[model samples]
Target: MPRIELKTKIRAKKEIVFDLARSIDLHKISTEHTDEQAVDGKTSGLIGAGEWVTWRAKHLGVYQNLTSRITEFKRPDFFADEMVKGAFKHFRHEHHFAEVDGKTLMTDFFDYTSPFGLLGVLADRLFLKNYMKGLLVKRNDTIKEFAESERWKEVLSS
Candidate 1:
């Protein structure tokens, strides 16, 4: 398995950052570059424990569908979502939040195994790992942007 961990500080409350992290609508906006869409299962609003979502998106010149479910959750603190079905052999994404000096520290741990054995390893070494990290970074940047600006109300208030 390959793992990527990252931490981002946002000038917002943990609750706001947490809610923004789980907002399906905001996810769509963050991944617009990939044309990602939430096709089924809690396609909008906040996703909570036991909730699942199916996403369709274009990646690496191919369109794919992936479904994942929230396996664990603690409001304004942590959450884990694992892949239920996807091209990957397996994947689990954990989100953690902490309040530090009145700011929210958001952390991500992404662990995944690629398919096709040796071929997958080669791909990871070449570009897949960086690609995955880029996606997460982009998503976190979006979360930070929304949480720190009035733009949050556009996603959270509705």
Candidate 2:
């Protein structure tokens, strides 16, 4: 298994940053470059515990569909989602938020295990880890941008 951790600071409220992190609409916007779309289940609003979402996207020039469920949730603080079906053997992503010095501190912990045993390990070491990290970074950057500006109102209100 490989674990990727990232910390981002947003000049915004924790509540706003938290909501933005969980918003399905915001995710679609963040991944627009990848042509990611929510094709089923809670496609537009804040995803909560026990809720699942199925997303289709283009990654590495291939189209893939991944379904994940929110296994844990704590409003304005933390949440964790685990892959129910996808290319990986397993994957779990945890999002955490806190208020620090009047700013929001957002952290991501992503853990994943690839299939094909040793071959998969080699792939992870060669590229998958960095690729996954890049995706998370892009997503967090979008959240920071939206949370810090009035643009958030557009997604949150709808």
Candidate 3:
């Protein structure tokens, strides 16, 4: 298994940042490469533990459909999503948020295992690891921008 962690500071409320990260619409916006939506779930509302969402998107030049459920949810603090079905042998992503001087410290923890054995390891070493990390970094930057945008302002104001 490979683990990738990224941290960023955002000038937003912890809850606000958390909500944005969990929003399927925001996720689609952040990761523009993937066309995804929350079918049979809240598309724009808060999601809690035990909640799940089904998403369809393209990966590795192939169309993939996956269902991931929220295994852990701590309001304004942390949440974890585990894949119910997907390409990887295992996929789990945890999002954490902490308030520092009224700003939010956001951390992302990604753990995954490729499907094939030694070939998977070699592929990760050759390209997948860096590719995945780069994707996460892009998502983080987009989230930072969206979290600080006027939409977040309206959400926080209300």
Candidate 4:
């Protein structure tokens, strides 16, 4: 499995950051470049534990669908989602938030395994890991951008 860890600092409350991180609408906005959309399950709003969402998106010039469920949740602190079905063999993404000196610190732990055995390992080593990291970074950037401005109100209120 390949793992990606990212930390982002947002000048906002922990609860606000946490909610933004779990917002389905914000996710779609962040990945707009990929034309991602939620086709089933909780397609919009804040996704809570035990909720599942199916998303269709274009990546690497191919359209793919991935379904994932939120397996764990703790308000303003932590949440985790695991893949139920996707191109990868398996994947898990965990989000953690903490308040430090009046700012929110958000962390992401993303682990994934690609399919196809040895070929998958080669792909991960060559570019998959970096590609995935880039996606996470982009997502975090969107979160930070919204959390730091009045834009979050639009996302949260929707």
Model 1 TM-score is 0.99
List, residue by residue over 1-158, the lDDT tens digit for candidate 3.
99999999999878778888877666777666766555565455556789887777776787787788899988878999999887889999999999988889999999999989999999999999998899888888877887887676543343
Each prediction's number of clashing residue pairs:
0, 0, 0, 0
Report the C-alpha lDDT of model 2 over 1-158, residue by residue, as the tens digit.
Answer: 89999999999999899999999999999999999999998899888989999999999899999999999999989999999999899999999998899999999999999989999999999998999999999999999999889999989997
Order of models, best lDDT first? 1, 4, 2, 3
Please give the range of 10 consecutive residues that has the lowest summed lDDT in model 1: 98-107
State how far residue 47 of model 3 sits from its true place (Å).
Answer: 2.4
RMSD, each candidate, Å? 0.5, 0.7, 2.2, 0.6
Better candidate by lDDT, 3 or 4:
4
Q: What is the lDDT of residue 87 in candidate 1?
A: 98
Q: Is candidate 1 or candidate 3 better by TM-score?
A: 1
How accurate locally, in lDDT, is each candidate?
0.97, 0.94, 0.82, 0.96
- Can you give the TM-score per candidate against the true fold? 0.99, 0.98, 0.89, 0.98
Which whole-number lDDT from 0 to 100 does residue 23 have in model 3? 70
Clashes of 4: 0
TM-score result, candidate 2: 0.98
Candidate 3 positional error at 91, Å: 1.3
**lDDT: the better of candidates 1 and 4:** 1
Query: What tens-digit string does per-residue lDDT give for candidate 4 at 1-158?
Result: 89999999899999889999999999999999999999999999999989999999999999999999999999989999999999999999999998888899899999999999999999999999999999999999999999999999999986
**Candidate number of the best TM-score:** 1
Clashing pairs in 1: none
